[model samples]
Target: MNALAAELRGILQGPVLVGELLGRHTTWRIGGPAELFVAPRSEQELLAVLHLLAQVGMPWMALGTGSNLLVRDGGYRGAIIHMGALQTMEFRDDGTARVGGGLPVMRLVRQAVRRGLAGIEDLAGIPATVGGAVVMNAGAGEQAMAGVLQGAFLAGAEGMEYWPAARLDLRYRASAVPADRIVAAAILRFSFADAEMLESSVQHRLSARRKAQGVGKPNAGSVFKNPPGQQAWRLIDESGMRGRSVGGAQVSEKHANFIVNRGGARAADVLSLIGEIQETVRGRTGIMLEPEVQVIGEA
Candidate 1:
């Protein structure tokens, strides 16, 4: 271990795991070990860890639920800060919530439903952290975080500060939030709604997702962003790439846009399959599909 690793292990308020396999953390169930993995219990601890990382000039990456991520087989050389321990969830007297970025988005959805709040009912099915959702503007159809997110708390070299949602430039499964900073928390504004109506909407979305997606398999949700006026699944299906397989990775037959691990898929297999789909779709439709899934680390 290096001097920096030695110091961090001694000072951090949480576990500093060495050679931690990322496959155990991601939804895809694939990836090699990270050089160091830290799960800070409080915002102060998180900042301290980041400060130490900056002092040593060691690269670091923020980890959410790893829903839409692909970490390569060679693993990441930098430190990974898992935000699961930053699980604060506070509801206000007004119809808004102050949530820890690490809270599972669906858990937030359930809380909102219980509170008879609207805005994120349609997002009940997405497997993402609130922080990840904000970064990607995760949504389905016409509903998205942009509609409810009021502001975010960001921490980086400049220290922690709040930025309103309008300033974040969120749009279409993407956000302008800098990749280097960590989202510590967010404020979401919601409206009062009939409890029955909210529950109905949540269930409907969840059911629709289960029916349309590959449910029993381990996979990130969608592999490609839908092009304007065209769904990615439709394009992939039209290109005759449905059910395509590369090693253990397979483009889901149930939903052509999702790539699933049939049991033991490697990150390389998933990447190769994504490439094949992109090539075939572009060749057929003259439109390129952008990947919604974030790929990281090495091959």
Candidate 2:
């Protein structure tokens, strides 16, 4: 492990953390330690790290704020790449914003509102990075990331390149970005709007999100994606699973679609709760609920 860490450190300018606890980096405050954790300072450094990993046949996963992820209790054996350093932000005169994938979605929304841009204000409160948002098609009500994304820069072992939004094949809480690539940056389009009006809309959206999905507990936002025309929260509520618990994991009382950690929760606890919810909902409504939050790493 030390040798691998030293190798990773040798290849990149960013800090390489050995055996860093994944819980500290994730919003859920769960998961065990990562064998090799890195925060690459640039895309070039990231590509270098990738090449090294490929040469050694080591597995890895990209992380963007960790708001929509769950790592198991046993943790991941390979690299965990943190994209927080690539937070460059630039707005064009043609009503488009060129932003880094590591930039927080909330920050983008807030900045857009300040610039009187109207498109992603409804996504103001989602606790995800731009890359994560793009991958998950993250949104609220009827708006989604698919609606605003123009294109993105993706990085792979071969090289970094731009893939238009049309190529992304973004759907509800999912995207077609190949597992081999990572979002490096993105270009999003927005329309001009009154700054005051945009700010007001953002405020309203934040309030609505808090009232509906915010549980004031450690959680990975919505647990399940809304299936077709039906809402996952409605189904869970109708199934009487609200406030249900397994170990330290519990179905949020505020929102049935969310599973919150009361304290000392494990990935197994959450997974068990998710399975129970899916089974109960499927039996009652005949619709199997799919998770919106990603579950990764070992058991």
Candidate 3:
């Protein structure tokens, strides 16, 4: 252990897990371990811990609900700051809702619907956090975080600040949220819609997703971004890579884009399968598939 690790062990007001298994945290349920894992309950505690980490120049990554992430089998050499406990939600009189980074995306969606807030009903079945959703610009159809975000609070080595949605450079499945920074909270502007209409929309979207994506398995959502004028799943299905397996990981028979862990899949297994699919698809169709799932940890 380094000096910084030693110091963090003494200072943080949270559980200090050494060699914590990351597979248990991720939606894919496949990863080795993180050298350290810390969960801070409040923004102040989070900032204080980060300040100490900065002082020591120790590396760290922020983790949300682990929806769109794949950690390597070799594991992360540094620390992981888990935002699971920072879940706080508040609605303002101006028809805006303030949500913490750790709040589940589904929870937020349901709350917004209950309050008759429109714009995020399309996000009904997404299994991530507000921070992760915003960072990745996770969306479907024509709606994304960019469309509803009013502003966000970011925390990083340089410190914290609030920035408007325009500053985020929200593009397709990407955001200007700096790699080193963690999204602490967000202010979302939503229009008041009829409760019945919002509920109907949410249910319809969820039904579509359930039928199309079947998102209950131990798998990262979509493995690759859709190529121009072409859906990735359609391409993969056409390439004849469905039901393919590498180790315990297999391309979901129900959805070509999803790589499911049949039982005890490893990170390397999933990655190898992903590489195989990408290579095969590119070779056949001449269109390179870009992975939407975020691969993290030491190579």
Candidate 4:
């Protein structure tokens, strides 16, 4: 493992940080250090890093913008691949667009809107990269990646490959992409619309979100998935869990489903708060809360 780590450092063209604190990368800003971190810039560099890690059978994980993730206090033992520099987007003469996985979701939305594309306007306030959005099928049922994604380019043990959207089997907040595969880029299809219409749609969604969501603090978006026929926030609020705190982690008063970091919170604190919400809500409503946020690393 040590030998592989050394060799990895020698070959990468992008920045590599050893013992990089994960708190700096995540939205909640509350994780421990990662043993090794690499941000590869191009397809060649990304493939190189993946190949080297695979050769050693070293465990690794990809991090996008870290919008809906949590890293524990004990930290990740393997490589932390940050796909930030793979920011490429090409709009075709046809209605299809090619987007790099690392490009922010809103950035693509804005560009597409300017080009008179309309499909992604509802995804305006979703804070995630294209890759992350596709992997998790990010966005609401009214407008989501599954609605427009044609296919995705991914890198895995078999090297680079394209998986059509049908093969992905995207579900609510999930995709069946092979665990070994990491999304590299995506092919998206959108409808033509007037630029003014797209702009108005984007602004409307953003305004609605701003009114309904908590702001001015660090949060990992919605902490729990809404149960069948029940909104997670409503359930949490009914259970009187809003504004509840565990250490520095608290359920946002404005949005019960959001867990915010009230500064200097630990991963343990967030986990504890989540557990408490689950227990309380379950006891009150007979429905166990399922987390929307992906918790990784060790406790």
lDDT digits (tens) for residues 225-261 of candidate 3: 9988999999999999999999999999999999999
Q: Per the 3 Å backbone cut-off, how many clashing residue pairs does candidate 4 have?
A: 0
TM-score of each: 0.97, 0.97, 0.96, 0.97
Candidate 2 structure quality by residue, lDDT tens digits, 1-299 = 78878987887888999889999988889999998999999888988888888888888999999999999999988999999998989999889988988999988988889988888888888889998899888988668899889999999888898999999999877899989889999999998999999899888988888788768899998889889999999999999999999999999999888899999999999999999999999999999999988999889
- Candidate 1 positional error at 276, Å: 0.9
Q: Backbone clashes in each candidate structure, one number apiece? A: 0, 0, 0, 0
**Candidate-wise lDDT, in order:** 0.90, 0.90, 0.88, 0.90
Error of 2 at 58 (Å): 0.9
Candidate 4 lDDT by residue in tens digits, 1-299: 55666787788788888889999999999888888899988877888999988887878899999999999999898888998898999999898999999999999999999999878889998889999999999985289999899999998755899999999988999999877888999999999999998898888888889988846689989999888889999999999999999998999988999999999999999999999989999898899999999999988
lDDT of 1 by residue, 227-282 (tens): 99999999999999989899999988888988999998999999999999988988
lDDT score, candidate 4, position 223: 91
Q: What TM-score number comes out for model 2? A: 0.97
* Model 4 stretches astray by more than 4 angstroms: 1-5
C-alpha lDDT of residue 276 in model 4? 92
Provide the lDDT at 155 for model 1.
80
In candidate 2, which residue pairs get closer than 3 Å at backbone N, Cα or C atoms, i.e. clash?
Answer: none
Q: What are the clashing pairs of model 3?
A: none
Output the lDDT of residue 105, model 2: 91
What is the lDDT for 173 in model 3? 93
